[model samples]
Target: MSLAPRVVIVHRTTEYEELVARHGTHGQAAFFLGSRGRDIEEVAERHRRTRQALAEVSAAVPLTWRQARVERADLDRFLFAPEDVVAVVGQDGLVANVAKYLAGQPVLGFDTDPGRNPGVLVRHRPGAAPALFPSVHARNTGADELTMVEAVADDTQRLVALNEIYLGAVGHQTARYRLGLEGDGGVVEAQASSGVLVGTGTGATGWLRSVWQERGSALRLPHPSEERLLWFVREAWPSPATGTSLVGGELAGPAGLRLTVESERLTVFGDGMDTDAVELTWGQTVRVGVCGERLRLVG
Candidate 1:
């Protein structure tokens, strides 16, 4: 006899639920929102709809499969097995949040409200879980293999970013760092900038696009499924000890970027989760490159 395949549904607390949890009651939450010129009823309705969608998905799971539900906040601590299929029940960002932790498992992203959250990642409707499960179980589903960016520090501590990786001062202020890139040979430069951004093809439209807009470059960005990555040094200052020549470029094939922390403290975080970050002191080196694992997202 074989064990039943497990389905893990990932979700987050709705706005109304969070407000009530913090305020200890609906009355207090309403009062707080009313003072801010926000209507509590709107939030409450959204919460109601989100719960209804989740309930529908729960009811649609196959009867023979084992099931579990996880909140977004608790994903860092939750243990996932090799045979688990992840069902993300939230906006697109939630899919990125969960992508870094997965290796080859198939992910089904369900947008609770398609009207408000128009997403590229979360394409399926909540009620589509039952129809989506069989293909995922057989591993022949239509999916996109999204590349990821990785930052390895001291060769041990590392972070895999599904969207992009940020490296800079702990406060994101202008800081000092020795930046190096591996090309045909090798190039190293010192820079005084706000920070550095390394993003994957899937992230080109997000923060990477903003950075590209500032440069006004004519170069085309990578597509969402490409095996390439982009790097940009934000606001590189031309000073006596630093230069701005190697500010932006593409990293492909065997090329990568290295940063030596010249400031008192530097932090490296992935997918905009600042809480789950690695801190580096002066003289520490961190390498940013393509990750070995990829995100298998079912459409």
Candidate 2:
């Protein structure tokens, strides 16, 4: 069996050398710098004191050692090959994950925030790979949002995403989309507000929070449920008479759609990513997995 690859990081506040001395340093590594502890010994000593206080009854053990610190974009540019395993001590999105891999950790991850959105599938593949290779994918959100990209040959990679694809408003018009949801008998069609949040446990945090804060949306990103949360709303002018308010909770679906403000455009926003509105018409609907996948996380 192959010995699993290891890379230790004394992140944000953890002591690097202390980890080394207490855990021993045979197969492990270290990379940390703190102002309080100017040298490695100081850091290690503090860790010893802290540990003694915490594990009053037990003894501290040494750890496996193999560590380094490399933080540059040019140097950090690589993907996770199936044969590698990396350990990390930080938090970041996909881009950050890629950077860590380049930093040398194969299987890298921090704690998971159930409140944020999950891993999303890139609508377009990012780069070119060799003809054949092996890869993996993880769902950042719910059970259905599983996405994996495996190599077909020596250097090729194929990706699969579980969540839905999104199109943000650019500037011309609203990014209108006819939302399609899974129904008991078949599929249900409806008009979405600015954007549709097809999410899992992970998605509820970011986009859902903005929705609640911005529009005061009637819905909360309910915890990851068996059923996907769907929001349908259309942009329209607030009528002085009895129409919905275009300010707060104004963008709503059938239950609140008072009238269709036949303006020049309509569009949706995703994760507050859009600056100028993206032009969308009544005829387009994007397809995305939206469901989440299971990903093992290390503390």
lDDT of 1 by residue, 66-174 (tens): 9999998888899888889999988888898988788788899888888888678889898788788877898878888889989999848889988899998887788
Error of model 2, residue 238, in angstroms:
9.7
Runs in model 2 with CA error above 4 Å? 1-77, 88-165, 184-193, 213-285, 290-292
Model 1, residue 288: distance off in Å is 0.9
The local lDDT score (0 to 100) that residue 156 gets in candidate 2 is 25
Clashes of 1: 0
* Residue 168 local lDDT, model 2: 32
Model 1: residue 13 alpha-carbon error in angstroms:
1.5
lDDT per residue as tens, model 2, 178-275? 33332224433333234333333344454445544565567545443323333323352233332332222211111111112223344433322233
Worst 10 residues of 1 by lDDT: 180-189
